[model samples]
Target: MLPLLPLPHLNREFDYLVPAEFDEAAAVGVRVRVRFAGRLVDGFIVGRVAASDHPGKLGYLERVVSAERVLTPEIVDLVAAVAHRYAGTRADVLRLAVPPRHAKVEAEPVVDPPKIAAPEVDLDAWASYTHGAAFLDAVAAGRNPRAAWQVLPGEDWPARIAELAGTCAASGRSALVVVPDQRDLDRVAAACEAVNGTDSVVALSAGLGPAKRYRRWLSALRREVSIVVGTRSAVFAPVRNLGLIVLWDDGDDGYAEPRSPYPHAREIALLRAHGIGCSAVLAGHARTAEAEALVDAGWAHDLLAPRAVVRERQPHVVALADSDHALARDPGARAARLPAIAFDAARNALKNGLGVLVQVPRGGYVPSLACGKCRNPARCRRCNGPLALPSAPGADGAGTPTCRWCGIADANHRCTVCGSRTLRAVVIGAHRTAEELGRAFPGVPVHTSGGATVLDSVASGASLVISTVGAEPSTPGGYGAALLLDGWALLGRADLRAAEETLRRWMTAGALVRAGADGGRVVVVAESEIPTVQALVRWDPVGHARAQLDERIEVGFPPAVHVAAVDGSSAAIAALVEEAALPDGVEILGPVDLPEGQRHPAGGGSGRDDGFDGDVQRLLLRVSRGSGAALARALADAQAVRSARKNTESVRVQVDPIRIG
Candidate 1:
């Protein structure tokens, strides 16, 4: 029996005796309540054995949770593999894999799958990319073919993904497509339903309350739906005869789970594909370094359009730093937030009765501020945290500066440097940008999409849409032009994937504009010489990803080497390192104190709050690619040791974390 316990030492399966009364109901993969350590706990029957390996006598299961089998044999193996890869407990992975039991839904009779004819395959859609049609054909032929697809700018990506699903379903196999957000899920699910019939596809997401989520999950579990499209959590959906797994925009931070184990959706999809011998497609407008690594390793082929086709589909991208000529054209181009070129692009789009999209890096009114005199970053005196103006100024044109990290407002503030009291916006946000654009272009309707109020789509008429990254709204006929403002805000982040992330967001917003051949334009407020901006201008995501992978290899970062972040009390971190049998060539980076905002409150347990007197230190463990599995095993064993000793200090071990500074 696999006990539903997240403790590291008890991560393994346990032996249990089955009572005669529940013999028939206690089949493999069925949920059951078992007596573990003097307490009744939930678990699943993973296997049946006639002989006991344990020297001690086993206790009988208390009762069967339900006769319906929720866990599948395939899922059991998949979850185990995921746990091992992530240095996490199987119970932790299983929590993400299986939804909480809904007795009412479980008791409901299983609905029979509908008999719907698969829609005809649209080869024309795949014809744009080399080998794209062949990839679909292989899926239809029941053969696994992996590819990292770079989607064209003007392509109907959802429809293409739907076509792939339809082809797979036509071959009598299931397909699982995982997107990053509800918006993408809705679009892809709608397209899948249109191609494979409503009954054949089920959309899954956390936004759906418990009952609805379990209902949809049950549908897939019973094989009533051949296509499952959902957000990150749906990667573990138990679809039968899985033929294909597709992950869209794998670089999006939404794909990273914030909980324990912190598994990425892309890695999960790849693992599932490998285990099931199924086809895999990593599709996105901007490619990730991890995806590029797959291509470089010859594990997957690149599906890309020709250069000519790409040029025709993408917008005419321009960067303000492209030339000194730009500075001559507009003397204040380098300093002005919205220079003459941006104004001209917006004016032309508005004159043509087309919508305009303004992409901002931040979301609030003023997410960051600085001393107006010395240009020093403004900080809170109480907590020494960054200060910001979250809303517009008062009637007297004065605004209270509040600490972003700690909710304290500093009415009487002074700059540590130059002793200045006046403040200026270091980073502008979507709301403030909207207000400014409204004034810049009088009578032109301006809308903001970010924070609590995000619009899914806007009318394709003459108007301005100001949105923060990842929250840009779509229009019916596509926007006429796009303005990517404040490039430094995204590019200057203290992150390894800053450039890649910035490019992905830029490409996503830029792709919503009309084709450049038809007058679509994208203006980026960044240096022209920067590789990321140049990649966007040249419409070369593939090359950019390849370059990024090469850089990572040179620097020995992720995708080239395996890295784990261990954060906890200094003693706990040191103890873990000393306990673990670290593989040879493992490089230990630090045991440095965590940033002030990231430090945990005072605690003394090995759970989420594990730390020392509210102080947390982080250490990075790096190993060669071939030693990744060893590193994971070593970390898991160390964690198990701590759990066994009842260590009061909790430590967080995250493998291949999304960000490492």
Candidate 2:
């Protein structure tokens, strides 16, 4: 019988002897139902054995899931290495490697895939691709552009991408392309279909129904499809003769799995490509330091467009930093979504038949509020809470909003600083932006892109679109102007990556600016000259990443040191820290309390600087990477030993966490 374990559980893999009664059912890579400690569990056969590890008798293998093996030898080996590197169990890594049994077992009708079947065919699907055909051809031939590349300025990208997909189809090899999210998948998938034709491609995503997902997965493993495109988890799609691996937005946090081992798609791509020696491209308008590191190490060539091409495509972005550049800028443009100058710009663009994209601080109607007199926010009388918007509309055709913490109304709100009750909204959301623009532009249809909505809502016309970061809407006619607002929202975060991250966001929003006859107007409000701002103004993300790395190297931050986070109750955290067998040279940033205050995203960890408990625990541990595998191993060993002790489970260990204060 198979060993019993929880869903996605690691630390256990059962060994079952093939029973003479059903020897046909047992084979490497086949899923079998097994009797675990107290219950039936689903598990794959990593190996079949004649003898049992346990002295007692072993049970017969359960029914086989399928005859064809899905866990290819190459992938299993990769899992082994990952298990060792992350100091995790085999099951943990495979949880990511293998699809959920439910998602697979319950099947659905397979859609006919599109084909630009030959990777070398250039069908002009990618809008406005200048050298897109040539670039696609080169990538298919396993060549990388030695120069910088730019996103061609229009709708032809589909044809360009389809023309290139021909390369994969030609070699009778399969391919997997991973983007940051579902929207990108849609954009690329359409292009793949247009160029490749029908039945030649399939999309693998968690978004699909389980049964249908499993069918596609099984088909891919059996080499039925030549191209598989998806988000992060698709990294493990079972494509046969894997030929090409393409990843866009490598720096996106969405690509990082929140589960154990926290394996990132980028790391997986690098390893997968190396294992198969397939042609690979890590492409995005912005570059990550990790990608730059790959370039520095001679792993991949830097695909780029010429400087003139970049200049022509991207607007002449300028930073508006007052001497110090409120460098502390708000992202939502709360003070005024349309400051006179920016509003005027938008008006001009729209009147001229150009679409405009307005980025807001948050996605909802009201994310934050404060008192005008004292700049203190109103709170709920029932609970020590900040206010929030409700889901249903109020009497005024607006949704009801309330405080998430201590659920209460702001009818009796007050400003503690001045002992006054006059409170004003401090932050603006996408909904508010839409509302305001609807009134300001009068009859200019405004759409929104955020949360679960796809980018398709945005149409090809001179309409206004309000968006938040990742969900920026795409325009068919393309945007004539884009308002990148609330610089502080991007800059003021306490995390180290705040500036770098914010800059990337601004550039991403700004990238949608229309290609003007001359250089277009891309006015960024953050103070100029700050590295991140400069990178935006100059369109130099690569340089920005490198410069940021240099700072990290100097300060011994990540990329220079290995890091981990242990957060929990004060006693539990203290106990773990005291008992931890942490390696030497480890630095602890805090035993300091996380906010025990009212609930809110900003309240993740309350501030003692203001009014917050200091007893709640959170701390950062950093060790030099120069220590090599030995150190990582030792640390993981320590974490594991401590973690296995049963006391550590209460305190989470996040290796290489992105959200650190």
Candidate 3:
């Protein structure tokens, strides 16, 4: 029996005797209740054995939870593999894999799955890419063809993904597609429904609440749905005869689980595909360094459109620093939020009766404020957090400075550096940008989409829409032009994926505009010399990703080498390192104190203040690619040792963390 214990030392299975009354119901893969250490606990029957390996007599299971066989052998093996890879307990992984039991749903009558004819595979959609047709043919022929696909701008990606699913279903196999969020899930699910029928595809996501989500999950578990589309958690869906697994926009942070034993949906899909001997596709407008690494290792082939096709489909991208002459013509362009070029683009689009999109980096009215005289950043006196003006001004026609972190208002504040009360906006947000654009273009309806009020789609008419990063709204015939403002805000982050992520957001928003042939234009407000800006201008994400991957290899970062971050109090971190028999040539970096409110890369929060009251520090462990498995095992064993000793101090171990800063 596999006891549902999260303790590291008790990760293995235990022997249990089966009572004669429950012999028929106590089958393998069924849930059971057993008395473990004088307390009744839930567990699963992993296997049946005639002889006992333990010297002591085994105790009988208290009772069977249900006669339904929920866990499958394949899932059991997959969970074990995932647990070992993440240096976590199987119980922790299982918690994410299986949903809580819903007795009412399970007891409901079983019905036959809806019968629908599979939609014909459309090869024309895949014809744009070099080997796209070949990839689709391989999947239809039951052959595995792993690929990292860079989708063309303005392509109906959901329809293409659904076509792949339809191809798999026509071959009498199942397909699992995992997206990053509810918006993508709805789009893909709708496309799948369009291909097949509404009842043929199951949509799974956390926002559906417990009951509805479990009902959909049960449909997939019972093989009633051949195509399943969902968010990150759906990666572990128990679909039978899996033929293909697709992950869209794998670089999005939503794919990373913010819980213990944090696992990325991309990696999970890869693992599941490899284990099941099925085809896998990583489709996105922008390529991630990890995806490029897969191509470099020869594990996956690249699927990209021809240069001419890409150029025809993409917008005419321009950076303010593209030419010194242009900057010289408007001397204030460098400092002005909305320069002459931007105004010209917006005016041209508006004249054509087309909508315009403005993408901002921040989302509030004045995300950052500074002293007008001394040019020093303003901070809260209570918590030392940054100060900003609220979305609305005060009754006196002037806005009061408020602490963003602590939410404290400071109406009569004086600059600490210059003893001045005047304030200036260091970084403008979507709301302020919207207000400014409304004034710049009088009578041109201006709308804002960000923060708590995000619009999914806006009318494709003559108007101005200001949004922050991922919150950009879609229009019917696509926006006429796009204005990418404040490039420094995204490119200046301290994180390693700053450039990669910035390029992704830019591409996503830019793709929504009309093609350059149709008079679509994109203006970026960043230095032309910056490599990221140049990549955007040239519309060369593949080249940028390849260069970034090469740089990571030279610097020995992730995708080239395996790294783990151990976070905890100083004593706990020290003890873990000393206890673990790490592999040879393991490099250790920094046990530096983490800044206040800074979370670990794996989503681990500040160190738990149980009995120990010490500052939290993070220590990084690096090893060669070949030694990654060894490093994971060593860390797991060290954690097991700590669990056995009943160590009260808490420590978090995360391998190949999402962020390394």
Candidate 4:
């Protein structure tokens, strides 16, 4: 029986004796209860043998949880392969593969799937690219081909992907699509419905309730759908006769798993294709270093539209630097403030009876606050979190300060640097931008889209729509003008992919503007000479990513070398490193101690940090591509030893963590 427990020491199947009374119910792929470690635990029946290989007495199957075989042989093998690749236990992979079983749904009769018919579509978008038609033809013929696509903005990518899926389905095969978020899934699902009917595609995401998600999962497992569209976790969807796999926006942080082993969705997609001999497509607006490496290695085709079509489809871009001589005389061109150029562009767009788009760096009423007088960052007195101003002022004649990190209200925040009592915004948010724009254009309708209130599309009427990055909505006729504000907040990030990510965000917002022929204009509020700004003005994301890739390869960082991040107590980390059998030429960075106050929960701001924990140390392991598998195996072995030795301290291991800094 494959033990359901995730203990590192028991990472494989164990022998179990089937009792005579339960002979009829004992079968492979069914859930069974067994005696493990002196306690009753659940396990999956993986295999059966007539003779026992061990001289020791085998544990008896305590009871059968279910007679239905939930796991397929293909899924079992895929789970094992994933566990091996990520240096994780098989049970951990299974946890991600299968959802909790719902008894009521399992008891229901399996009805015949509804009829699904394919629809005709215009393949002009694919034909516009150099080798796009050939790639689609290969997919239709069931030839396993790989492509790396740089999807142009406003390109109906969903419809294109659905056409590809339909082609594969017509050839008697299935497809799996893994995107970054639910918004992308909605778009993909709708497009797939247009091609392969509503019942042909099944959508899976964490947003669904337990019962609903499991029901959809079961439908996919039962081979009731030809295509599966979902977020990160759906990379492991068990599709029969899988032909094509699509990984969209691998550069997005949402593709990285935050749990143990921390496998990436891109890696999983590659693994699935390799293991099943299926065709795969890695697509995004901007190329990632990893995807570039694949193209360099001659494993995937570089898919893109012709230069003439690309230039025609893109809007004209302008870069407004902070050091412009005109800005010195203009009092409002501060780092966190808008400039006259932006104001003029908005006014012009509104006068033209077209919508204007303003992209802020963040959300909330005030995401980052500072002292009004000294311009020093404000912090909460209780938790040392960055302080922010609430939507309104308090009764004490000052704005109420709140912690953006811990959500603690600090009405009496005093800046430590300059001893100032008044608060001010260091970074303007979507709401504040909307408030300012509303007043700037009196009687003009101002709309805000961010966080939970993000809109999918907006009308192209004469108005202003303020949004944060990744939340910019589509307009009916496209916005006449766009303002990318607080560029430093994005470009100045202390991350390796800062420049690349900043350019991607800017291009995403710029793409929403109408074409140059339609009088579309985009004003980026950043340094004009910066490479990112230059790339934006030239509309060259592919070149920017290539430069970024060259820099990384020169420095022996990611894409160029395999990296793993380990964080834990100093002793635990030391033990893990000492026991690891890293290959030759493997480099180890510092085991630097991180600031306790800066260490919030893993994902984002959850609560207050009292700094009670002594200190957390982190180490980075870098090895060449040839030694990556060796390093992962050594880490897994070391973890197994630690588990066997009963080490108390817990260490977190993440392979290719999204933010290396």
TM-score of each: 0.97, 0.84, 0.97, 0.94
Model 1 residue 170 lDDT?
81
Report lDDT per candidate: 0.89, 0.65, 0.88, 0.81
Residue-by-residue lDDT tens digits, candidate 4, 507-538: 87887898877888898888788998988887
lDDT at position 432, candidate 2: 76
- Stretches of candidate 3 exceeding 4 Å from the true structure: 396-398, 600-614
**Compared with the true structure, what per-residue lDDT tens digits does model 3 show for residues 546-595?**
99999989999988999988888888999999999999999999999877
Model 1 backbone overlap count:
1
What is the lDDT ranking, best to worst? 1, 3, 4, 2
lDDT of 1 by residue, 1-661 (tens): 9998868999998998888999899999989998888898888999989889899988999999988788998999999888889899998898889999989888788899766566777778788888887887788889999999999997889999998988888889889999999889999999999888898999999999999999999999899988999999999998888999999999988888776787888898988899979999999999999999999999999999999889989999999867788788899988889998899999999999999999999998898999999999999998888999988889874558899988888877899999988999999978889988999999999989988888989987999999999999899878999999999889998989999999999999999999988889999988788999999999999999999999999999999999998988888899999999999999999988888544432111133334346677899999999999999999999999999999877798889988764
Q: Choose 1 or 2, whichever is better by lDDT.
A: 1
Candidate 2 lDDT by residue in tens digits, 62-138:
66766557678778777766655544456667777887665335344444433334543434343234555566566
Best by lDDT: 1
Off by over 4 Å in 1: 396-398, 597-613
Q: What is the lDDT of residue 560 in candidate 4?
A: 86
Local lDDT at 359 for model 2: 78
**Model 1 TM-score (2 dp):** 0.97
